[model samples]
Target: MSLRKQLNDILPTLLPNNPAEAIKGTELIRLARINLTGNYSDASLRYHFSIMSCDPTSAIAKVEKGQGYYRRSEPLPALSGAQELLAWTQGRLDDISGDDSSVDSAMLRIRKFRAVVTRYYEVNGRFPFAFRDPFTNTSPLGNLWKYPELVLVDWETGGSPDEEMSLDGGMLSLKQRLGIAPFRLHSARLRLSPSLMTYREDFFQTLSVSMWAQGGELIYAGPIADEALADGLRKLSAAYGVGVTSFGMTPEVLDDLPRPANILNAHPKETEAIMAKLDIHKIAAAQSRPHLDWVALNSLRSESEEADKLVAWLNHCIDERRAEPFKDE
Candidate 1:
């Protein structure tokens, strides 16, 4: 069967409302242009179809349609069109939702959707109607980031910081020195958490690993000038059982850290005075170590029946963590 027919049949089961109608309309338009006129480009067809998946009556949807025209008119307009469409979608969603709490939830969904579309454009040099499972003919929020290993990090803090140390200065400095773009840096209080008060260094190590698993890099930024704190960070890195790199508290080395430009435009920096004492390292090494390998534990659960129940329990905790609202500091 033609892909359009398959989609037409499947979409009703999945959407069954205005969204379905929009998708069907998009498919019909695409098929007619292709089968009869043979003038429609795949990129143009997919772009229109994806936009139609949004509410056709929405102002953002209108902008999306305009973007399609722009994309068809020229080669370089695809990225601009996609970017504008995303911004409009986000703005429209915010305007309608009018709920502060749902902002992160909504952004998360949009980012995931953006990531997929951006990747497709990057590879194919055009927008695509590539509706993968969760995003199929539905809003991006239908499925957000999910990893079954996030729950291992304890969220409760024993108390507030004795003195709030703003790491913005250090983070900006690190970004300048490293020449990396801005990325989310977890606040010191959030990073140190139950570990500092509990005096359980292992907890701090676990927290580092958890963040690494969720994001990719672990950055601890704080007053490393203190020798004791510096030593503690080294120990944390060692305990983390990952590849470790330490700049100590020396401003010279810290300032000398390699600056790599990236699209994220921000690097994760550990910046809590109390929590900043740990050596930061790439967490990729953990995958080889079974005890600390959350991914391996989860993926291999079926193969290793003996650990299936334990893995399932661990995954359940991770799911609970994943469901929690995103905390951006």
Candidate 2:
């Protein structure tokens, strides 16, 4: 049987009294483009499902890969401090330099740097630039350039810092120095209850992996539950089905995470954060207007009224033109 159908059959048995909860959660997962499935716990009788949407090559991956590691398994080269900022700046330098040798050597250097940054904070109990505000280019909360020597090195001459460069002279240099690349790495944290927090992280990661695996672009991430997760997933599923049957999901990954919240919601949230994050506005609209063909037919009446008004205006203009006549020579 189809996964959706199987889910439908199992849902009643899982949550006899709370089928609505299952529906609500499932719907939200679909909308959020997260993938998950779960089994009922005999002890609690509460279907404990996880949200799975984080991508393997997500921002977390970038941080890890930059430091020659994986996920949260190992120490990163930078850990949200001045040293991290330096490393980030240096990464841009390497990108700009286009130094093949440096690129090859960067993984080791990044790992070492991540370790150093962690230790720097261990002794000092503070990060290098906790709030440098990279987007605004202002250190409103923290000064990243605590080390002047590092700053000098960052802003030094615009040449191939370590040669091995080629790509229209200074173009490659400028690109790296300015941190202008096709791929950018970023990370942020959100607040949520322990239960909700776990779900959110799982959902984010699952979505990330699916998107990357399918060569899709990322949008954003956040916690969702109650009616929100339900509504989102339903809309998403309607637009795109679930599991390995879907373009970007694997059965193993899908079965490992949270069940859809839609099955549980009697009335899902009209406004869900996942919809906004994924830019699934169109999908949401379509779901909301399931009878969109009827809407178009109704809208045609308004168009007809407008057309009548235009016809009257055009006739009036023609009459005026006739009255005025051609006075030009």
Candidate 3:
């Protein structure tokens, strides 16, 4: 049997699933040798490990921004990811035909991506408020057009990067005195993949959901590798004023990320390591408006409870003369 075959059979048992607990190549080779045949040298074993880790079906995986190997969990089927997203958006959950394992894996990736985006923006000084209810299983079909998955608030704050900042009092006062809104609201639509077949829906959904906000953005977990897709997104963004960006999360890297809870609660060091894995690319910049569409925003109050909470939260912060990360409670 080939060494790759032997490693394929042997590595799953030796490699840990968690990336943080990945076994270094040196140690993995040592353990793998006990079960590997043909007396492979360390260099040969290392080379095999490197090559095999790149194979999606292989039991082993290399961390994207770190050393060592971990067990690569089985990914959501490549072709089905978009289909699943479609079924989800249409609220036809019954149409998504997958076994429990695959469905759970798909949902986990969606959640981890959300957690990653939330943390990414927060650390970059944008406060993200997720409208979870609109995307939940209980939501009605076509809600994607009616509600954004996230609303990112960019506030003018004065403070060090290491600490949560209070709103810049002078800026706040000036905006209030001038009767201008004190923040930029960029509504965002998050998706696991960016595909030619689905980019239009993604872009239009982002635009529809953010009609009331100052700007809109379509964010994808995976990189935008296809030039035609990039061009298409750029054209739509140019015409419609929506932003398009990717977090550079390939399916493999996404599967290797920590679970949603751990990601959301990541410490500064852990968050830093995770952030290092991102390759943020801006396909197009969102055009901001000088003012929000108040008449359009008023229409949402009849549809989404989240819309009310969003308004109330902003009012609370403005009234208190401070800016802070949101707490659900």
In candidate 1, which residue ranges exceed 4 Å CA deviation? 1-217, 243-329
How well is each residue in 101-218 modelled by candidate 1, as lDDT tens digits? 5444333333332332223222322211211232222334312221111122222211326322122344445654775422221111112111121223323433442442322212
Clashing pairs in 3: none
Comparing 2 and 3 by TM-score, which wins? 3
My TM-score estimates for the predictions, one after another, are 0.20, 0.16, 0.72
Global local distance difference test of model 1: 0.29
Candidate 3 accuracy as TM-score: 0.72
Each model's number of backbone clashes? 13, 61, 0
* Model 2 error, position 242 (Å): 22
Model 2 per-residue lDDT tens digits across residues 120-197: 222232211111223122322222211110000011122444431212334435654774421111111111111211
Better model by lDDT: candidate 1 vs candidate 2 = 1
Question: What's the candidate order when arranged by decreasing lDDT?
Answer: 3, 1, 2
Give all candidate RMSDs, comma-separated: 24.4, 26.8, 9.9
How much lDDT does candidate 3 score? 0.79
Model 2 ranges off by over 4 Å: 1-11, 14-170, 176-183, 186-197, 202-227, 230-329
